[model samples]
Target: MRGNHVIAEAAIRAGCRFYFGYPITPQNEIPEYMSERLSKIEGGVFIQAESEIASIHMVIGASMAGGRVMTSSSGPGISLKQEGISFLSALELPAVIVNMSRGGPGLGNIAPSQSDYFQATRGGGHGDYRTIVLAPNSCQEAGDLTYKSFDLADKYRIPVLILGDGMLGQMMEPVELPPEIPVKRLPPKEWTITGAKGRPSRFIRSLILDPFEEEEHNWKLMRKYEKISKEELLWETFSIEDAKMIVVAFGTAARIAKGAIKRVREEGLKVGLFRPISLWPFPTKILKEISRKVKHLFVFEMNMGQMVEDVKLAVDGGAEIHFYGRPGGIIPTPLEISRIISSYYYQKKLG
Candidate 1:
């Protein structure tokens, strides 16, 4: 199945009942799949919102009512949803957002690109906030991560993102769908504005007019983020022990780098790949430890050099840092990446 369809199906299996999204390229299949499947289920609702802004607000509303909700988009559409996302975070609402990212500062094109790394890692909206970001490098993980994202969102009562790209969304691959696993455990939504039927009324708003109250709210959010950083850091490493050079990449770029690392290793170069499965709360500590053992590190991405900054901060100049990338939807093939590494190695060797 296509990655978008797998995610949509996984959401259903994970007991997500409400979906609100605007149609956008490379991800329209998500909404299209949900539109057909959700309406047929009992008590399920799928709405094709008029705009990305409206769609995100609708997600916020459904989540406030204690519904498992989701919305998907690409680059520009994601920008439109940021304000609503910030609102969700401030209110500590649980929701899932998928970005089948395309190349862009504007509407660059409907091709895969990882330019939104900074936007997703740092808060895209206007505030000091963080969201749990998951990067799935394959169609299987696309489905698997989408299934797990709902749990993570509810566990933290914050937004969780499944960040993919156009290529992953459009491509098809076999994925083993898990049996319908009912969402049995979720933090009590005692704060939900279901009704004032028996007890005192509750409010679900991000506003706290008093200065001290607002500061308290921010501190509370930070505490949750800190706990997440400590307990939820996830990554995958390959061939790192005794390696002289390491390649760091994420999402589709990581998948490609795996192949590149294989090619380079076959040529008897000590190289490996370090893939961050979780982007935010990045695996910085692991990178720091690995950097101390390697002579050089390469950060590869589909964007110009977004993740390289994070790599630099993590490595902290423990090793020589290099970057390789192509923007505007140009994907770096395994052969191309291997060749680049070979060139750099030979140049340094001659010098």
Candidate 2:
């Protein structure tokens, strides 16, 4: 299946009954597929929203009403959704947002790039809120993680982001759809303003002017994030026990890095790979443990030193940390990565 199609099917199986989004390159297939399939289901609703802002709000509204909702977009569209995302976080609405990143600070080309790292991992919108961001490296993961994103969102009562690049969105691979897991329905919306009941109306506002009240709310949010960091950090390690050097990467960049690691191994270099599946609640403890064993670490990404920062924080300078990447749709090929690793290996030997 194509990656976007897999994600669409997975969303339906995850009980995502409402999908509101605008068409964006590389990911338009998701909304397009939903258009064809969602209406076939009894309760499914698919809307081509006027804009990304409207789309995100629509999802939030649906979520507030005790429905599983989702939206998909690319970089520019994602920027438009940030405001609503912050609103969702403030309200603690459970929703999923998929970003199949293309190039850009603005209207960049429709090609794969990991340039949106800061925007996704860091809060792209205003205020103190964190998004649980998942990075999927392959077409299968693209589907599986999209489903998992919704579960995580519901578990944390926060928005979850499935971060992918155009390459992952466009790629085709075999994917086995997981068995339908029962959707954990939220309690009745007594707190949500479904309608004016006989009792006092409920309000959904993201405003707290009092200093102490705001501090308390912020602290609660922080505690939730800390708990998430402890429980949700996820990663994959390949052949690191005897590794002299470790390659750190995530999403599609990690797939390329894995290929490079295979090539270097063929040439008799003891290189291993570590790929983080969760970008925000990064697998810091595991990376730190691996860092103590490896003498050197190389971080590969499609952007300029975004995940590298996290690697440095994890390793804490225990091992030499190096970086290599290309920005704005320029992909680092397996051979190119191999050359980079080979050069670093020789440089370290001489040093």
Candidate 3:
């Protein structure tokens, strides 16, 4: 399955019947697929809004009405949707926002890049809130994690981000797809503004006029975020036992690093791989635990050192950190990274 198509189909299986989004590079297939498939499902709604901003606000509206909704875009488009994403967080709405991220700062390129790490993990929107960010490396993970995003969003009543690069979004792979969930069997959202028949009327609002009330709301958000950080952390490790060095990466970069690690290990290298699945609730505790046994950690990214900062903070000077990056949409070859790893291993005398 094509990566973007997989995500769209997975969203459908996860009971995401409402989708509002605009077409954007590298990720246009996501919305395109939604536009086609959603209309076939009973009660499904798909809207190609006038713009990215308009699409995200539409998502907010659908989510407020207690529907499983999603919106997708690339970097530039996502930038336009940030204010709406902030509003979703403020309103405690459940929606999935997909960013098949491409090169950026400002419409950099359609080529594969992980430069949006900062934007995705650091709560790209303006506010005192955070969204759950999931990074999927392959078409299978791209589908699997996207299916799970909706549940996480509704469970926590927060926005969930699916962060994928152009490579992951365009790659073709065979995937074990999940079973489609019947829409009626989906989880109930009691807080939504559904018709208030015979019940006290309730309204949804993000605006808290009182400073004290707003502060309390922000704190409330923080506490929920803290709970997610503890319970929702996800990561993957490769052949880490008795390893002297570990390479830290995520998504497409991590897939490349995994290949590089395998190549080097064939020649008796002690390097392993650590791939974070959830970017926001980073696997800090586990990474820090690995830092105790491993002293050298190599960080590789498609961008100019975004996730590396998270690694540095995770280990906190307890280990030696080396970073390699390819900015401006350049995807490095596995052999090139393997050679770099070998050189660093010998130079640092890590065996």
Candidate 4:
């Protein structure tokens, strides 16, 4: 299955009933698949909105009505939806957002890129809130993460981001599709804006007019985020035990780094790979533990050193960190990365 289509299909099986998005490269297949597939589902709905901004707001509406909702786009389109994302955060609504990012600053090409790392992890919109960020490197992880994202969003009442790049979005891979979940089996959302007819009067709004009330609301959101950072963390490690050097990466870059590590291992070098599946709530504590054992850490990314910052914070001076990056949409091969890894390992005399 193509990665983008897998996200759409996985979402359907996960009980996502509403999808809102505009056409954008790399991820256009998500909406295209959703539009055709959703039309046939029992309660499914798909809308190709007039703009990305409009689509995100539409997501807010569906989520407000207690539906499993999603929206997808590449870098530029995602940028246009930032304000609504902040709105979703303030409203404390549950929704899934897919970013099959492409090269960018403005109107960057449709080719694969990971330049949105900072944007996705840092709560791109205007707010002091954060959305859970999940980075999936392959089609399988992409599908699996999308299926899981809905649950995470509802569990925390926060938006969940499935971060990917054009390569993952466009490639084909054999993925074991998730089983279709019955929508009726899903739990009810008590906060939905259903009619207040029979019960006591109630309303939902993000406008916390008074400054003191807003401050409390902000702290409440921070408390929720703290809870997430504590409980919701995911990462993968390969050949990490007894390693002299570790390479930290996520998403597609991690896959490449893994291959490079394998190659270096065959040459009798003790190099390992660390992949952070949850970009936010980053693998700080565990990574710090690894740094105590391994004195050298390296970070690789398609973009110019965005995730490296997190790696540094995790190591916190316990390990010496090195970085190699290919910015501006240049995809490096495993051989190229392996050479760099070998060179760095020997230079540090860790052989």
Clashes of each: 0, 0, 0, 0
Sliding window of 10 residues with minimal summed lDDT for model 3: 120-129
Cα lDDT listed for each candidate: 0.90, 0.89, 0.93, 0.93
Query: Candidate 1 regions off by >4 Å?
Result: 183-188
lDDT, residue 129, candidate 2 = 93
How far residue 270's Cα lies from its native spot in candidate 1, in Å, is: 1.0
Candidate 3 structure lDDT: 0.93
RMSD (CA, angstroms), candidate 2:
1.9
Badly placed stretches (over 4 Å) of model 4 are none
lDDT per residue, candidate 2, 97-200, as tens digits?
Answer: 99999988799999899999999999799989999999999888888888888778878889999999899989899999866655555333345557766877
Cα RMSDs, all models: 1.5, 1.9, 0.8, 0.8
Worst 10 residues of 1 by lDDT: 181-190
User: lDDT by residue for model 3 over 1-351, one digit each (tens)?
Assistant: 999999999999999999998888899898889988988888989999999999999999999999999999999998999999999999999999999888877879999999999998887788788999999999999989999999999999999999998999899999999999988898787898988898999999998999999999999999999999999999999989967889999999999999999999999999899999999999999999999999999999999999999999999989999999998888999999999999999999988
Q: Residues 77-159, candidate 1, lDDT per residue (tens digit)?
A: 99999999899999899999999999998999998999999988987998779999999988899998999998899899999
User: What is candidate 4's local distance difference test score?
Assistant: 0.93
Model 1 scores a TM of 0.97
TM-score of each: 0.97, 0.95, 0.99, 0.99
